[model samples]
Target: MEVSKKNKLNKIVKEIETCQACNLCKNRIKSVVSRGNENAKIILIGEAPGKLENEIGKPFVGKSGQQLNDLLSKVGFNPEQDIYFCNVVKCRPVRNNKDRKPNKQEIEACVKYLNAQIEIVKPEIIILCGNTAKKIFKINKPLKMVHGSCIDYKGIKLIPVYHPRASIIDEVKFNDLKKVKKLRG
Candidate 1:
């Protein structure tokens, strides 16, 4: 990455850390930022941070994270070197009952940061790993309908896939990831 780009990303991360754009920030323990190579060719975007991710201020560090990691290995991608992991909402959206999906307002508030990351990374492929991510990308179809298929959005290839935590875990999702690898190449 260029020095200027690195500096710009740092500036964005700082802004995210201190942002008070929505109510999600009010209860967050830490603002979960991105992890992995800044020059990564593939970016994996999830919906929001879960409990463990919130505690660590890192995206994809929970059970779902483990699943993702395994999937990456199976597809011959390196998390630390080839892919940048992030979430649509940087903070955990907790409610009275349990950690819940980020509401529309919260998603709206945090999307700018995600957009900034996309611009900075300029990834060749962006994996929208769940419904919320697909929604943000304006992909109206169900994940099952489009998962593994790459859609050209602007110039980037957007691949919708099932969230790692989704109830159904199967080889089809793994196949989808393999498709991602092929597309990345």
Candidate 2:
């Protein structure tokens, strides 16, 4: 099962590597596919790649990723072994040569890849790490208001949380992360 899952994920990685469906394809140094364990039952979704991620071609590998790693550790989860890290938009969203939120068109174009990742991984829990990630699930509300509640996404637990860059872990986010430790296994 793990081998098939890994094979399917590898195909998706190749597909993402050559994606030219959006304008981001023009400026991106590399298309950030995903990172961490493919067999993980948990998926951590961020908004898009940052500068480091764009350069390295992996999601959640910047300073923010380190912070997220610490948080995951505090919550009793191992990022390398338990979480499948990805982003809503694969390429780094940029404006004025600085990282920026992905626009609607970009999100729409790359959403198929995100959807495919989810389908292949079939994770039991999805942690939406910021508003952009959360909004893709059609929950149009502020992260402050919705963070930490587990909404059902096709039988999977969908959790909205502040971005690691924001460093804002509310009570709900903390408890939710802590509570899911048992499920990580």
Candidate 3:
């Protein structure tokens, strides 16, 4: 229906929760639509939900999420005030082997929701975290090779960065997150 701009956010979220738009819906415990200030200038797009996020019905709530919070704080971004967080896919793409990566079908299936979130949030800049996000945007370059650079995505400025979980394994990359604050300025 004709959801007004005021109610669009909540309405879209509710619709997503009930969405059978894709096969991912069948296994979803909850749809991780998005979180943070609706009016924020920047949106942080993650890959997908992990176990903690799925359980809490929130985006970025796991250990990686905590690291992400610290990184944001280092860059002076307060999620409640300055940033929006979402995933390219609303549900965690399942892997029977637990090591299998999310396949193209899963990514393609959920793209509509991701696009809708972007359309609704309408942020000035999008901080794309990790390879999944980069690939969705069609940037095939390695993350380390392209992180911190800004590129246009259908009129929005997209900045690619490492996923917070990556930092848990590499640690050195944590220092590079300072660049996020520059987008605020």
Candidate 4:
């Protein structure tokens, strides 16, 4: 079953690499696919690829990635071995030669890839790591009000959390992670 999942995910990754569903693809150096164990029970979904992530073709490789790694480590989770990381939009959104937030149309165009990933991974818990992810999921409430709470969405558990790139207040993030860990376990 795990092998099948990996195979399907690999095929999806290839599709994402060649994807021209949105204009973001035009400016991308590489489609940031995903990272971590394919069979992970926990999946972390961020808004989209940032500058460093776009440069490296890996999601969450910038300072935000480092912060996420540190937080995961502090919480006793191994990013590479325990959890999967991805972004709602695989390609970086660029405007005026600078990284910009993905627009609604762009996100709409790119969401199929993320949905494919969710179907393939079949994670028990999805950590929506920011407002964009929350918005995509139709989680309209502010992150502050729901960051540590879990919601059941179509038989899968969803947890909204602050984006790692957001203000780095360790205590707040840690508390949210604790809630996720508890819910995951």
Compared with the true structure, all predictions reach lDDT values of: 0.89, 0.86, 0.78, 0.89
TM-score of each: 0.95, 0.92, 0.88, 0.95
25-74, model 2: which lDDT tens digit per residue?
87688889899998899999999998999999999899988878887898
What tens-digit string does per-residue lDDT give for candidate 1 at 1-185?
45676788889889988899998888688889798888898899998888888889899888889899999998999888999989999989988837799999999999999999999899999999999999998899888799999999889999999998877666978999999999877
Put the candidates in TM-score order, highest first: 1, 4, 2, 3
**Which pairs of residues have clashing backbones in candidate 3?**
none
Flag regions of model 1 displaced more than 4 Å: none
The TM-score, computed over Cα atoms with residue i paired to residue i, of candidate 3 is: 0.88
- lDDT of candidate 4 over 3-107, digit per residue (tens): 688788889888988999988888888889899998999999998898888889999899989999999888878889889999989999888878788999999
Better lDDT candidate (2, 3): 2
Local lDDT at 168 for model 4 = 56
Off by over 4 Å in 4: 1-3
For candidate 4, the clash count comes to 0
